[model samples]
Target: NLKIILGHMGEGLPYSMWRIDNRNAWVKTEPNYPAKKRIADYFHSNFWLTTSGNFRTQTLVDAMLEIGSDRILFSADWPFENVDHAAEWFDTASISENDRIKIGRTNAARLFKLEA
Candidate 1:
């Protein structure tokens, strides 16, 4: 029903995923799922991420973004960053509008796939 492109994964919240997944102590109680599952199950080829906010290069954020923009959306991180900041980096981000559409909201419509 939906899709996106993953670029610069490990660009966000992925390393943390490893931490959560590897937590033997936590796994003992919540054996059904891992802290990262809420985020990782979303992974798909169509899922995409832009290098926009690689500023922090948070593996968790990047990995999560790679999992899908549905979880990660493009933000200029304004005040702390800028619109052009995201735009400039995104220009060469190496993903497509099929994925871009999601970041731009076209994919949102399809997810919500609204008629309006």
Candidate 2:
């Protein structure tokens, strides 16, 4: 399975997934459309998201609840956004310590198969 990682909190897909899926179910796609499963199915199976420029806590928590921590990775937008701000926000985020560790470090290591 090809794995794709999206930055900027999935470019807002986490919040829009339900709507996308709902519309997909309500409307018929063109015959040329190839996807047979729900958008959330693809997200759960093949996608990962990064906490890049987006730093809102409620948004992060919403994403975590929608997609689970295993599919998230921490990222600093670097030259585009201050690393300190990202670090400060993430360090003080209200998520549980277990989830914080997973999102901040372990998830990437596990996805990349790197030695810890």
Candidate 3:
């Protein structure tokens, strides 16, 4: 399987996801998308989102609820964005400890197959 990581929560891909899914669900005409499942479904299965420099609690909560935490990775833009800021925000995000840990480190390790 090709590991795909999406930067900046796919740079508003989630909004497009909602639009695609909504359109596909409501419209009955022969759709242009040939996928077997909805766009959001594909996203859930194939894509990973990184927080990077976009660190907003509401956005994080929204994404976590919309897609999930397993595919969300913690990242710092560095030079441009401070690692300390990211860490600080992450440490206090509204998500649970388990989800926080998953997004913060475990998920990345699992995705990259890092041991220890």
Candidate 4:
């Protein structure tokens, strides 16, 4: 199956992941949507998310905790946003340096199989 990449660091999906997991079952009776796994499972296995313009540290941290650092991608949200701002926030975000590197560049490079 093709990988599904999510932008805006999941566009608040990390928060919703649990909510869906909790509520998906409740909604199952209302809607006919069927899934064999928890919502977070799909998040962990099928999706990759980008920081893009949503550069909030707490949300980044929450996403990392909820999904994983390996799935997080970085972007400047160019045209609509400023690269310098993205850079500054990323540089100062409370997460570890390794996590920063992984999200900022390595993850996307690996996801796209880019050559150094």
Alpha-carbon lDDT, every model: 0.51, 0.90, 0.85, 0.85
Give the backbone clash total of model 4.
0
At residue 98, candidate 3 shows an lDDT of 94
Give candidate 4's error at residue 17 in angstroms: 1.5
Q: After superposition, how far is residue 28 of candidate 1 from its true place, in Å?
A: 4.8
Model 2 Cα lDDT, one tens digit per residue, 11-111: 98888889988887777656456878887898888999999999988888988998999999989889999999999999999999999999999999989
Instruction: Show the colliding residue pairs in model 3.
Output: none
- Candidate 3 has an lDDT of 0.85
Each model's backbone clash number = 20, 0, 0, 0
| lDDT for residue 20 in candidate 4, whole number 0-100 | 79
Candidate 4 residue pairs that clash: none
Off by over 4 Å in 4: 26-31
For model 3 the local lDDT of residue 3 reads: 65
Model 1 regions lying over 4 Å from their true place: 1-12, 25-66, 107-115
On residues 3-99, what C-alpha lDDT tens digit does candidate 3 reach at each position? 6788776688866888878888988787776788887888878888899888998888877877788989999889789999989998998889999
Candidate 4 structure quality by residue, lDDT tens digits, 1-116: 45988888787777887787788767646655586778788778989988888989988988898889999988888988899999999999999989988998888888999957
Q: Report the alpha-carbon TM-score of model 4 versus the true structure.
A: 0.86
Q: In model 2, where do residues sit more than 4 Å from their true spots? A: 28-31
Give stretches of model 3 more than 4 Å off: 27-29
Candidate 1 lDDT by residue in tens digits, 2-112: 665444443444545555445654655656654443444554433455444453434423544446555445555465567786676655555565655565565445554
